[model samples]
Target: MSTNPRGPNAIDRHVGSRVRLRRQLLNMSQEKLGEELGVTFQQVQKYERGANRIGAGRLWTLARVLDVPVSFFYEGVSETLNQPGFAEGDQTPIIDDFIQSADGVQLAQAFARIRDSKVRRRILELVRTLAAEEAEAQAAESEQA
Candidate 1:
């Protein structure tokens, strides 16, 4: 394994992503997080963007500030590791990726807030119908093309 410090490794990126996800879930801004860690917001941005590697001491501090266990940063990381019968580290962490996105997070939060089962079902049905219609439209467009 190349120990290049010019850029963050995949594991560093994954850990950084987890940090960003947890911070966003709490609606904490980069500035606030940086303030708590005694670093600039730009450093936090670099961390989130996987442009810089975070040290163990800083990671421990982040876990404490974020009110999460250190293990939280390693969740879903198995998908990124080399596995047999497949390209090394080629697996997609689809579910985790979605939960980490702003739209996905917002949708999940909204869905969870809906206490009515019927409402949730109706929302799901509405989304399914919209997706189906969009798919059909795209197919028709391709056929026309």
Candidate 2:
């Protein structure tokens, strides 16, 4: 059930997810971001979860602190919205969903800091192999059960 006529919408969640993604990509903790925004970490959590809507002024301030243009928050959002002139993009509306997660963000940030292309490629292969092995193991276990 929703709370009100104008409660947090899908756009709000998308924006918050972007905020969390950007903050994670910067390796910034929620507490650190909150300190920068002069808010408590809990409030930051709320904003990140889209439980509370971000106001325009706060969004402007967040843009500066997050070192991203205000438009960054709206990047994939318009794809899900059916507003006039807001359609037709190759961007997947849910693309940010994974990177917005704690694990996904940490993996991406760590992988991004790798300067050696060879090492990066090796790591990618290793991860692929591990994932494949895990999937096979899960399938085998299911069969056994």
Best by TM-score: 1
TM-scores for candidates 1 onward, in order: 0.81, 0.77
lDDT of 2 by residue, 1-145 (tens): 7568678888888888889988988889999999999999999999988888999999999999999999999887766465577646744544565676788777877899999999999999999999999999999999999
Which residue runs does candidate 1 get wrong by more than 4 Å? 1-6, 85-92
**Would you list the C-alpha lDDT of every candidate in the order shown?**
0.88, 0.86
Cand. 1 TM to true fold: 0.81
Native-structure RMSD, model 1 = 3.4
Error of 2 at 56 (Å): 0.8
Model 2 — TM-score against the truth? 0.77
